[model samples]
Target: MDSVNSLLEGFGTAMSPLNLLWAAVGVLLGTAIGVLPGIGPAMAVALLLPVTYGLDPTGAFIMFAGIYYGGMFGGSTTSILLNTPGESAAVVAAIEGNPMARSGRGSQALAAAAIGHFTGGVVGTIALVALAPAVAALAVDIGAPDYFVIMLLAFIAVTSVLGSSRVRGFASLLIGLTIGLVGLDQMTGQQRLTFGSLQLSDGIDVVIVAVGLFAIGEALWVAAHLRRSSQKAIPVGRPWLGRGELRRSWKPWLRGPAIGFPFGAIPAGGAEIPTFLSYVTEKRLSKHPDEFGKGAIEGVAGPESAASASAAGTVGTMLTLGLPTTATAAVMLAAFQQYGIQPGPLLFERETELVWGLIASLFIGMVLLLVLNLPLAPVWAKLLRIPRPYLYAGILFFAAVGAYAIGGEAIDLVVLLVIGLIGLVMRRYGLPVLPAVIGVILGPSAELQLRRALQLSDGSLTGLVNTPFSITVYALIALILCWPLVRKLPLPARWRQRAGTSAR
Candidate 1:
């Protein structure tokens, strides 16, 4: 009842004329950023951080919320229309969406993605409203051991469950871990892999790594494979889903949020794992399983919905626990700090109005994104018609610029180039890029939690599994790691003999 009243009060605030206009502007800018390669919600928000300096906190946050959802909607547009994913989460969407675009079903693919996002976003927001306070209250009981275990689960899931080969996924994760080690150790105050450079003290920025791997690396590889004849884009009509397609999508759309929200709520959560998991689930359940790698609409629907729901869950975690799970959420955390707002259980008590307003704005943003994206999807598809040379050139330009913009340092550009080269090599060798990105992002945090746990236990390793929750999490990780080997085991001779006897 209290939640209901607060939400109603929030709607009153969010519906004001001034806030609505800000929401519209944010949605527009976020969509543009999403359509462009290399620019994600984090970069868009980071770039616009200065513009919000003078605005009131409520208004600024409302706009930021819009950008978050808008970027998600726009990412699907690029994935479907151009076979380019503006964010890592959208990579799953591109697997089927791009093929659909080539088959002249681009409009259908776009519609599925938009509707999926809307379904997931709306559901996720409701979960946030109901679960955030309780989760925040429980978070106080979570110690470093719990956090370390959760991080381990995330790491294992990404590396083991994502690509075709576990070897390649592990290799990618190792590379990301190595990159993550390139700074001063948080505990010892000693440099581990800096190689005596001043700029290396702070560690490589996540924004630069993301842009280099996804944007610049992709551009260079495409450029290398450029052919003499220009490729033509398939023409797309107005976006609409047939009754059959709609029937196929509804279940996955519902299921995606269920899988995505919990992952996003966790401290180590990121959208990549949830989206991939959703894709695998949809593939397993789909009647047309053979169409998965070709142009299955379920692939696009499930993953896009998961991505949006994960984003919403991330928002709730950020507000309730002050946890920043994804790169974009990290940027928003910084925004909160800029305004001297510390998010946590106390934040709700202290800043009730602002918190509810932000939550309400998220609901508002989802609707605006659906309205904006469904109508403009065809216009977005036209982006595919741009010449290859120009498109690749633009991607590289934005990648470099986004990297440099992370900090005003020239060395950032050098790092971008090196990582871009690595990305190209990974692409050439058929290695999945997402595991590496996840490794780099989560490795440092995991290390911190482990160290904190050890410190608390006076260097006793037993403390790592002190609680029932921590023990369960570790057991889950062990099961995930051993499942593949378990499947490979041969039946015992006695069991085989019994089966043969029964057959005889």
Candidate 2:
């Protein structure tokens, strides 16, 4: 009942005229940017981080919520029309959505995706409202050692689960930790990696790191692999659904959130797995399985809904546990830190209005997303026709401007370029970017907890595993690290084949 009351109050805050306007602006910008190839929600948020610098925290966060959901819908537009997924989560959409377009069912595909996104997002947000306070309540009992181990688990999970090569992922994480170590030591007040430079003592701003890696780095990479010819998008009309089409899509839309939300809440549980699982499940359950691979509406509906739901799940975990499950969540975590706010068990107590208001705005964003996407999809499709050089040039310009605005220091630009180059290198080598961003954001907190735990135990290593929670988390981490080796052990031929197939 208290949760219901708080949520109702949150609606009041979100419905204010100024906050509502920010939500509208975010939806517009997120969709516009998300329609372009290679731009995902994380990159969209990073590029536009500067725009919210002057706004109050509540308004900024409300806008971010809008951008986040709008990006999901816009990415589907590109996938359906151009067969180009803006991000990995949208890949499944291209598989069936593009074919639907080619078959003159593009409008139906768009309608199903838009409505499915609305369904998943709404369900997931409702789940978040119910789950986050409970999770945060449970988290209040955790000790420093337990907190440290949980972060350790996050580090291992991202490195091991994201990329094809654990080596590359860990390598990226190391780079991020190194960057994170650039500031003055919190305990001893000694600079570890500043090299006697005054500016370095303050640490690299996460804004610069985010914009550099996602925006500048991506722009440079696209420029390097510039394709001279642009692919034309398949023409689409206003998205609408018929009665029969809605019946076919409603089940998948419901099932998609069921699959996606839990994964989103878990460490290293990204939209990729849930979306794929939703696709496979829909294929097995569809009465018109024959229509699959040839442009089935269920294919467009299921995965897109899963992707949106997973995004909401990611936000829940971040708010309740201070753990980021995806790149976009990591950047949003940085946004929280930028406002001098920390997310954890204490967040609800300290910033009740902000947390509840943000949740309420998500509901608003969903409705706004459906309304905008249903009518303006054809307009978004036109973004694909933009010339590559012009689009990239604009990205680079914003990257520089956002970076420079951080402290108005000329040196920041140099740091931004250097970080951007490193980002370029990471992308070229198949290194996943999520682990690095996580390392940078969580590295300091992890270190602080480690030192506190050590101090409490008189410097004994056993202090780290003294608690039941810490022990369990360490055991889980051990299992994750050793699974690859366990998989290689001698086993029945059939079991080995099954393992191999699951691994792929």
Candidate 3:
């Protein structure tokens, strides 16, 4: 009954004409930006942060939610049509989606992708509505120490699961923490890391880092690998899948969300694992198993749906836990902090309307993007064919503009350029940049929380292990952090021999 009333209240807020209109505009803009390569939802929101300065918070938030859903919708398009995934979540979709396109049923592949996106997106929204309340209800008892513990758990899990090399991941995280510490000390009337530069005194802007690392870095990477090879424009057949195709795709759609939502709710490593799992499941369950790799529709459908579902699942964690498993989620969390809206267990109680409205808008936005994309995907693909030089140069220009706008200092632009170069170098050497970004975002907060936790427990390591739940949580963190090392234990000759012998 209480859930019903909360939902009713949510509908009242979501149904407002002003909110509805903003939601529509946000979906459109998100789709438009998502269609462009290297300009995903994180980049879109970060770039638009300055513009939200004058708008009402509710309206701006609704728009931000639309952009989030819209980017997921738009990401599948590039993966299937151009074989260029706009987001990491879209990477799995590109595996089979691109192959299906090359199989001369590009239209069928695209329709499957669109329908799958819609199906999974709707399911994701439902899951959000169903789960967020329960989570929030339980969170009502949580205090500052609980939040601190939760944040510590999140930081450990995120860094541990991000890269193959834990050392590298921690290194990246420390770099981010260092950057995050650049601003003036909050408790003191002094500065910590500002080397007397005026812009440094204000600390580096999150928007600058987001845009430069994601948008600018990607542009530079593409420019370095720009190919002049002619891509024979593949004809897109009828965009609508037949009833038979839809029937076959339904299971994958359902199964995908089941796989995806949980993944998004976990650490960054969690999402990638499921894509491989989904592919394996689809391959085994496919009625037309022979058609896999030869354009089996399930191959394209399952991963596409799962990836989007995973993307949606991150929202619950971000909103209720104030933790982000993915780089994009981290950026969104930063955006929320920028607006002075700290999302966590207390968020729903304090800002129920905003939370529910945002969830409701996702449902609306998914439908809107489906309608907009179904008949007009070909138009969206034109964004991919833009000359690389032009696209990259424009990105550099925007990075400069966004940097200057945020800090109004010439030094911010210089720092942005330097970071972009650092990003380029990191990408070149295969160092994951997301950890550094996450570290920068969470490092100081994590430190403060740790200090508080120590203080609360009277500095006894044993005192910190008071609760069974938290004790288990720490054990879990240790296992995850040491997983790479644990898996390398040397007593498994049978396992190693079996794998090597099987390969022979």
- lDDT (0 to 1) per candidate: 0.78, 0.87, 0.74
Residue ranges of candidate 2 with Cα displaced over 4 Å: 488-504
Candidate 1 Cα lDDT to native: 0.78
| TM-score per candidate, chains pooled | 0.73, 0.95, 0.90
Instruction: Locate the minimum summed-lDDT window of 10 residues in model 2.
Output: 490-499
Total backbone collisions for each predicted model: 0, 0, 1
Give a tens-digit lDDT track for model 1, residues 358-436: 8888888888888978887777656555666776777777666666665677888889889989999999997877667
Top candidate by lDDT:
2
Off by over 4 Å in 1: 5-26, 29-68, 71-113, 227-231, 240-307, 310-358, 488-504
RMSD of each: 7.8, 3.5, 4.4
Q: Ten consecutive residues with minimal summed lDDT in candidate 3?
A: 495-504
Show model 3 residue runs off by greater than 4 Å.
230-233, 269-271, 486-504
Better of 1 and 2 by lDDT: 2
Output the TM-score of candidate 2.
Answer: 0.95
